[model samples]
Structure formats: structure tokens, C-alpha cells
Target: MQDQGLARRELIAAGLAGAAVALPPVALAQSGARAPDAPRSAPAAVRAHRVEVPMPHGGVAAGHPLAAMAGTRMLLQGGSAADAAVAAMAVMNVVEPWASSAAGNGFATCLDRKAGTVHSLAFTGGAPGLFDPAVDPAELDSGHKAVTVPGAFGGWIALARRFGRLPLSRLLEPAIGYARDGHPLDASIAMFIRRQQAVLARYPTSAAIFLPGGQPPAPRALFRNLPLARTLQGLADAEASALQAGADRDKALMAAHAHFYTGPVAQEMTRFSQANGGWLRMADMAAYAPLWEAPVSTGYRGLDVYCSPLTSRTGLELCEQLNIVEGWDLSSIAAGDPQLAHCLIEAIKVAKADIYRHAGDPRIVTVPVDMLLSKAFAAKRRAIIDLARAIAFPRGADIARAGDPSLLALADDRSRGGDTTSLSVVDADGNAIAVTTTVGGGFGTSVVMGDTGLLCNNGLRIGSTAPYDGHPNRAAPGKRALLGNGPVIVLDKGRLKLVCGTPGGETIGQTQFQFLVNVIDRGMPIQEAIEAPRFALQADPSFYKAGAAISVQMESRFAPAITQGLSAMGHRLEMVSPFAIGSIQGVLVDGSGARMGGSDPRRMGYAVGY
Candidate 1:
């Protein structure tokens, strides 16, 4: 722990105290990539839970401490950032078992430092062929019926095979050890288990693992999922066997992919889905494969922000928000300034409104990607913000329309919850990756796949699609639901500057926008930026919903004055605990060439480096 603290001060010195800028000898110095004349006030003094962890070679930030350690093990053994990311995610599946699972899906944005190229990988799964678009959102099952074809495993293999330097067998070692042996149940996982007890109890496989003694395990109790261990070990064994049979590394990796998707595990998955009246089929498992696509990007000041494209809508939402707010003089606004928050809130609402209206499965629908990202469109959207009062949604009106607030409640009763995890890694050679993975809703359908111990994701969830037939995001056969995973990579003049992401369902892009602004515009170090307060514009009417009641959910840590100012602007506010929102795991490369990592203290996340 002391060593970790030292690593934190090292980056702080390189970025804030000496290399980037010389500060007055006041112990609480703070600085980063802000405009030269901006105030260097108390941002550095704001006592974050932990200092940023710095490593001369590289570092990793993840949702769990052991997960970060697993990634660091790869970096220590001379692996690429992709190798670290894959290894970390494998561990994340074991430790963060509720939010992520072996059968879950996600998106990745990876950078090859040597080529200075960043790419987006969509491992999101498609809705089953028998999917019923007419099913009510509330009636969606918490078990097999809500499942989509599992995509995360195939995606993980693709990343490791294409960009990683280590074997899948070796990467599986850490996770296998933890699962075969046991890791203590921390408060976070225990809390998740408590909330998911009802769903977990419904399935025998889930009940056997998550509900010991017919109840959630106590914190610090040793928990082991030996079945999951064997499942991963089987993949490792499959890879090893293929290697022994004269197969190269790529072929061996694919062999493992086949084992899970086309072999025994896939058969088990399809069998269960078929017997239980679920949507999955044997063909869905066999046809599941990840796609590598072009990332969507938009320039923000001197930085270029890139995000995973649709099927996730992260890029469209994030890019449009940044582009609309790019018209404002945000750099001059103070960190806790209400004007700054208002600009971001307004842009967030507009961006999501546009996204929910037009974004959909690119394979099935022609998304207006070009026009939605146009500067002229952004200008028109920015014109909608009154800058004096919050915009409300009226009956039969869209997000772009101004509405009467007197028509709706001050707070929304519409509550839908989901869970996910994120990780960021940078290898010694400068390669970096940002990834967000999820199992849909909490514990993900809460249905563990037989002896495989692979929990299925409820990817075909409520928000991913709409109730109306003409909705762009309406569920359909073979159409990939909007999985809502947004991983990001930022570049300064084509050089990697930041790798960051979080898991907040619809709030993913919104939280990421604030994190970026905190680092670039506010001159905050990665930790400060991550630890800073954030907000979400909740219940922005989706394509199917006509009325928009503006409810801004914010971390209560903001200054009372700031909250009062936003309330005065006519924005309905709901203050939550600081730890209740998104958990952003980020790594930054400072101007001084120091690599720093910041894991959110909001959850049980941590960072590790050599």
C-alpha cells in the first residue's frame, strides 16, 4: 500500500510539480493540460481517496484490485496492452461475477502505439432469431428468455489473438487459480449478491454458486466457483492440445474459441435455451463472431476523442455531446461552476435525444451517422439550450422540443438498473486499451449455464429496444441490441493521450464526457478527474417515450452553491452519494511522458503498476 502511494506521488510530481509545470511550494500543487492562464487553484488540494498510481513502464486500472494485479502480471512478463486487458477481463469475470460473465458481451477501443492507430471492436451479441419485439419491457425474463448469444468470450479471444503477445492458457491461469481456489467476497460483490438473491435463487446453477447457505455470503467469506474454473481450464487445455497438434498461436486461440462456441459449451447453451423456451439456437452460438470496425471520432479542443461505434451508441452520443459543447467557452469556466455543468447537461440531453432517435443496428437500419456527427447539426442542437432554464419534455414532444414542466412530476419514478465493469491498461511499450463489459442487468439473467458456470447476459433488455414497432432501436431477430458499452481513446495530434471508460448503461457516455473535460479543460490529473463529481440527465425520453421530464441526478459532493445555482436554472435535481454513480478506470500519458493510472474509489476498483 505504501509503495502504491509512492507511485501516486511520482506521477503527481512528474505531471504537476516539476516536469509539466513548476508550482509554488505549497504542498497541494495541481496541474495538467489546461490552458496556460487557467486558475491552478484547489483541484489538486481536493483530497482524493487515493493518489494516481504511476509506473515508468506501464500500469492498469480495473474494477477490482486482483483484476488489476492480473493485468499487471502480463505487463510485468513483457506483454502488450491487449494482453494485459484480456488477462484483466478474465479476472474481472471471476471477481465481478455479477456485472460480467463468461457469456456476456462488450466493446473495446484499442490502440497500437507503434502504428499510432486506434480501432474499435464490437463484441456485442445479436438478439435471438425468435426474439419477440412485442414483449413488454417489464415482462422480459430475468433468466433464459432475456439471453442473447454470448459474445464476450469470442471477443476476448479475438483481442488476444490479434493484438496480444501471450497464450490464452497463460492468461487463464490467474482467473483459474482464483476460481479453483477461492477469493474473499468483498462488500461490493456481497451487496450485489444481496440484491440479486431472488433471481439467483430461481436457477439451480446460479443458486449453488452465488447463494451459499441459501443466502448471500458474508463479506470476506471465501467463495469459489470450481465449475467456472474447469470451464476456463477446459479452454486452456483445448488451446494446449491444438498447439501440440502443430497448430500456431492464432489457430490454438481459435481452437479455444471453437471449444466454447461450437463444441461442448455451445451445445449446452443451445440445449438449455431450446428446452426452456428461450430465444437462443445452436446456430446463434456457431455464428457468433466479433466485428472490428472504424471508430467514431470528434475533435475537442486540442484533443481527439474516439469511441466504440453503434450497437452501443457510445460514439454517436459522446461525439455529438462534445461537438455541441465545443461551441462554448468551457475552459474559462471554473471546475464547480454551474454554467459549466449546465452546458454539459444541456449537451448531454440533446446528444442522447438525437442518438435515441436515430442510432440503431447498422446492419439492419441505415443510421444517419454522417449527418448526426455534422458540425452544422451540432450547431443547431446547441441553439436549443436556453442557457437560462432547463428544457422539459411535453406530451407528444421529442427531446428537441421545449415543454411545460407543470405537466409532470418533479422526479421520475422510472427506474431501471443494470450492472457492468470497466478496465484500462497501458503496457511498457506504450500500447493502450479501454474496455467496458457487461452481463446486461445485475447478475445477468441470473441463470448460470449448467456445469459450465458461465452466466448468460440479458443483452436483449428493456432499454436496448423500444415497445413501438417503428422505433429505430426496436428489438428484432438477429439484430444486435444496443448493449451500451463505450470504451474511449483520446489522442493529441495522433499520439495516445488518454485511455478511459466506465459502466453506467446509458450514463456511460455522459460520465466519460465529464471525465474528459476534467482532465483536458480543468487541468486535473487523472485521479482528480476521476474523483471529481459527475452528473447524469436521467429519463431523457427515448424514441418510444413522448414526454421528457428533466431529472438531473448528481453526486452530492458538489458545492452547495453549485447545486443551488443549477436548481435556480430550473433543472430538477436529485443528489446521490459520491460513490453511487459511474466508476471510471483511466490511464493517462502526461506531457512529461509519465504513464499514470486512476481507478475510481467509488467502487472496489484499484490500480497496479511496476
Candidate 2:
């Protein structure tokens, strides 16, 4: 079990490319496809609202400012990028507990400077072995039953044990201090608590910390979680005690891992689950371990794009979407152009359909990862995109019937996981990491894992992928929940170039797609690319719901020309606030090798460097 939790890193890069990108075969066959306003034109760029100081050595970008500070503290202490991320994520557990905690699950894409390669870490938790399919699965939507075996803590230690230069105690110090002392609640986080107060109020353990005094804390109110501090400290003490007894670093980290999964923490969680009529057992927790595997990748415009693989359709879909989009030279397509939006939206629909149909736990279900990532397969799927019109989204099984290979898709994920958190970090050594952690919807299932002070993910809600018996993504015992939250990495000319990710259930992949195009295709600065207006296909995109209600949540910042043009093409648009679509946190390595971090102005996110 300990070996399953540890891992080694490696690197992979693509060859250089010509200035002009080559389109796949059968591209541009749409004679009826409408053309852009100009033959080959791009839009003017704007100055970024905020500027970041370039960091030659290291930098950190996170969903919150203090979390970024926690990372910067580690970087300043000569820690690696992995160390910075561990510290920052621990702080996120304390301050932004409603979004991501030690109990959440997610994926992290890493650029290992030593190996000169990129890899993905899978911390996405799986279904419990005792999950009973005979019961009404809807009951798991937002309660103890919705919780899965949390993989976040497993992932945290996996990274620290392998790549960290400091001890676990040092990495978790800032987070413990914050929880033991106190931190001011951000205005937005306070509003989020108020919104989810009803759910938090249902559980006494959660209510005690989140809804103190029977109400949500006001903005800037001092918030503290002493129990959470003690819990985190206990993990650190486990590692410390092991080292005192002459254990090596890796063994000590294993001791910390054991303390959580097999020791007191696991016992408390199982007891809570049994009392609350949930399914989690000590076996599931003890056997849980994050996996380290090679990332899936594709090449576009001379840059190598990489994504986390199966169990999360995010990366697989990303490769498919990019493969479809790569069929055209996007250099002339500006960010503000309606034609650009049209092409992106269409590509997303195609990729979402295929991934929804085929993606699942590779060890359990049959996922055509190779076929889906192939250029030939993308060419076939690209044929379905009509340049001038929006195909009724979710194109359903008809997409598979239309020559693309697909299995029956009987389920879908409609949870608006806007409460997730994403962060990107880069150390001076060219080591870069992008992490997206979440508890599934806002405030997760609102079930605190007893005195462990952990809020679990509602992955079992809506069956993570679906609750259908024949579906690849259906909920099953010991199966990892298939997700769409993807943290992305971009490499140019075989070198680490950009890392970006965000929080927004289905918008996670779409946001990363638009951001990559902004930087690689249009050459915009990282911050400007992040702050640029974006759109998300909020309506269900699963193959099970073809031709269903389709809604596009677009930021109001888009000019009337883009919105009207999209509306004319059959996309039902819901105009939201300028920053409503996504909160992107990222870091970019410029041609000069300077690293700069960018945090979305949409939220209280910030980047720190020294």
C-alpha cells in the first residue's frame, strides 16, 4: 500500500514545429461554413488590469492570496515547487475549506525539472467498496453517503515524499498556524458560506466551524478551526516521531500517511460514516493511494499540450478539442472574434460527446484513450463541426452512430462545482505544477469527517459520472469517479512554457481551452489571457443528454458583435458578470525563461514571487 502511494517522476517533450501549423486531413471541407468578418484578422489587445513582478527563481499563483503567501514562504525557504504547492494547498484546506480540503480529490500535472518531463498525479478518490447500488443513489447527493475515500491527503504526501526538499512538518507549518490562530474570511468566501449555510447547519461538526453562533461569519470576521489545526499537526507529528526513531524521510512520510489512512483519522471517519448511514469503511481508506502515471499529450502550434488521463475526461477531451481545433491556423483568429468562439464551442461539444461516451476508470471500464487521442480519430470527429452553426449540443448517441466509435452513455454530471480551487506553481529549477482540488459541489456534501475536520467530496452525488448500470462512468464499488476537472500544462519547443487551471464544474476544461488559445495562438500575456472574458457551456454536455436544454454562460465583457453573432448561430446565451465564468490561476515561462504567475482578477486570487 505504501509503495502504491509513492512514485518517481519523468519528462517528455515534443519536437519543434514550423511557423505555420498543419491542418489534419479532411479539414476545411465545410464549403457551407461561414467565414469570419475578415479573411485573416485578429483583434487589438488591452493592457492587463494588474501587473506582476517577474520572478527569475520562483513564483506561486493560487485561488486565494494567503495561500499564495504560504507557498511563497516555502519557496523563500529554498523549497522546491512541490513543497510550495503542499504548503499552499494546506492553507487552502484551512481558509477555503468549503471548496477544497484534505478530504477533497483532484488531479495535478507536474513538470519535473530533474527528469525534464511531465507527469500527472491522480488523487481523485474512488467509490467505496460498500456502496450499495440497490438504494436510491440520490440520497448521496449532499450528505455523509455522498462522500468517497478522500484522495487529497494521499496526493499531498505522495508529492512531498517524492520531490520535496523539506520535511512534512515544515510544509504544513503555515496551514497549522492559520488554523490554530485565525484568518479573516474573504468577502466572497463569506458570501459562499451564507449561501450554503443551510447545508452546513445540517451537520453539527460542520456547523460548529462554518456557521459559528448559528450564522455565517461576516466578511473579515476572524475565523479559526482549532480541531483542524490539531488534526494537521497530528500528521506532522507522525512524521516527526518516525524520524526521531531513526526512520528515513520516505519512511517518515509513510508513517504520516499511515496515521491518516490506518490510524485514528481513518477510525473516526469510518465511525462517523456508520453512524450516519454512509458506506465508507476502514478498508477503503487504508487501501486508498494516489497513482503517478504518464500524462496524455498532443501537439499544437509548436507547443506540446499535456493533460491528466482517464477517470477524468478533462485531459482526454482537451486533447480531442485541441486536435479538432488544430485543423485550422488560429493565429489570425482573435480572442474577441465570434468565429473563434464558434470554432471553440463546436470543438468542445465534439470532444465532450466522445469523452462522455468512452471515458471511465481504465482498470474497470474500456476507455479508448489511444483511439481518442489519435490524429486520425480527431479528423473523423472534426468532420462533424459545422463552422457556421451550433449543432444541437450533447449530440448524444447519434455522434457515435455517425461513424465515430462510442459505447452507450447512460449517465451525466450536472453538478455546478464552482466551489473548486486551482493553483499553479513554478520553482526556479523549471519545475512547474498545476493542481485542481475540489469537494464536488459548493461546500461538498457538507459532511465533516468527524473530528478530523475534513469536508468530503460529493462524487457519489449524481454518481460522479452517472448511476446507470451499463454506463462506463456509472458508480461502482472501488471505481474512481470519472471527472472533468483538468489542470493543464503547455510546453514550447520541448521546454516548460505555461501551466493554467480553474474552478467551474464543466467549465474547467473550456476555461483551459480558451486560455491556451489566448497565449499560444494570439501571444497574449498570461495575466491578460486569464482576465480576458470567457464563455462556458453550463448546460449538460454528456452523451446521455443529447439535444437537451443547452445554455452558454458568457461573460458580459464580450462585445455585442460576438454575443449577437453567437446568438444568431443558435447558441442560447446567458450573459453573466464579466468575471463569472472561471477563476484561472496560472504561471508562464516566457521565451526569455522568466517565470510569471497570474491569478484571476475574478476572485480574491493572487500570485506571489521572490
TM-score for each predicted model, relative to the true structure: 0.90, 0.89
Q: Which stretches of candidate 2 lie over 4 Å from their true place?
A: 1-46, 334-336, 394-418, 540-543
Clashing pairs in 2: 11-116, 11-117, 12-117
What tens-digit string does per-residue lDDT give for candidate 1 at 416-485?
A: 5568899999888888899899998888778887788888788776677654456566678898888678
As for model 2, its CA RMSD to the true structure in angstroms is 11.9
The lDDT for every candidate, in the order shown, is 0.82, 0.81
> What is candidate 1's TM-score against the reference?
0.90
The list of candidate 1 runs beyond 4 A from truth reads 1-45, 139-141, 393-415, 540-546
For model 2, residues 1-610, the per-residue Cα lDDT tens digits are: 1111111110000001012333334333222222222222212333466565466788889989999999989999999989999999999999888788898998899998778889899998888998876666666778877888889999999999778889999999999999999999898889999988988899999999898999999999999988899999999999999999999999999999999999989999999999989889999998898999899999887789998887777899888889999998888876567999999888988787777766779988667688888888888888877889988765532333223333434345454343589888999788899998888888888888888888888887662566556767777889887776788898887788988888877778898998998888887778778888898875553344555466788999899999999999988999999888788999888888877778898888899888
Model 2 quality (TM-score): 0.89
Q: How accurate is candidate 2 locally (lDDT)?
A: 0.81
Error of 2 at 120 (Å): 0.9
For model 2, where is the 10-residue window of minimal lDDT? 8-17
Instruction: Using TM-score, give the best candidate's number.
Output: 1
